[model samples]
Target: MYFLTSTLNLSVIMFLASLSIPTSGLDCYSCSVCRQPFSKKTTDTMTGCTVCSISQTWVDGKRVTTTRGCDKSCSPADLRIKGNGLVKTCCKTDLCNGNTNLRWFKSVVLFSGLIVFKLTHI
Candidate 1:
């Protein structure tokens, strides 16, 4: 009985947590040739997107082209072949795919805050 009750409580908590996330689609930058590293002031924006993507191609260790737009799929990947390949990043939040390093930092901070909140509340 204790195990069943605990499981039920956990399920209810998970459902409530999911509801805290936004349901509306994200607003993301949409451009055919977005500048490398991205700049919000210089790019077009789109709304109602499931994901934001940045696709960059490189040749001989030099960046060749960069594109940013809204995507239906959400697959984040980085591939290299002899210093020449494509680096594609996809993010679900608004403008989250703009800067790679900055996005990572934001993720870390958000995760840490969530952990702290849970610990303190529990």
Candidate 2:
């Protein structure tokens, strides 16, 4: 009986752990099709489209860094503050997240949780 109970308890723990979101492995929507879906009455990128605006630091109409892929670890943000700076702009549209990977927030939450746990345990 004890062995069975122990196994059940461990199984529950493992299942719950799998459900927890990880700090790393943040991904978001991507593909140029998001920019202008069905441009000429034809499908491209095979993904739904939405408009999103990015206001990163730009020079000469060029962005510093760019990457795109489906972010399996993406969580929708209602009003995500870009950064603490002199100027910041936030815009949301259907496809805004297609080319962006906003994963830092997850890391922040994880770190905060760890800090709180250590403080309470100590």
Using lDDT, give the best candidate's number. Answer: 1
- How would you encode candidate 2's per-residue C-alpha lDDT over 46-121 as one tens digit per residue? 2332222223333444444332333323343433235322212222223334434335433544564575565446
**All models: lDDT?**
0.71, 0.37
TM-score per model over all chains: 0.64, 0.23
Candidate 1 ranges beyond 4 A from true positions: 1-22, 100-122
- Pairs in steric clash, model 2: 27-71, 28-71, 50-94, 50-95, 51-94, 51-95, 52-96
Quote the positional error of residue 87 for candidate 1 in Å: 0.8
Sequence-dependent TM-score of model 2? 0.23
Q: Considering every candidate listed, which one attains the maximal TM-score?
A: 1
Cα miss at 113, model 2 (Å)? Answer: 19
Candidate 1 whole-model C-alpha lDDT, 0 to 1: 0.71
Candidate 1, residue 68: lDDT: 82
Error of 1 at 120 (Å): 22
- Positional deviation of residue 85's Cα in model 2 after best superposition, in angstroms: 33
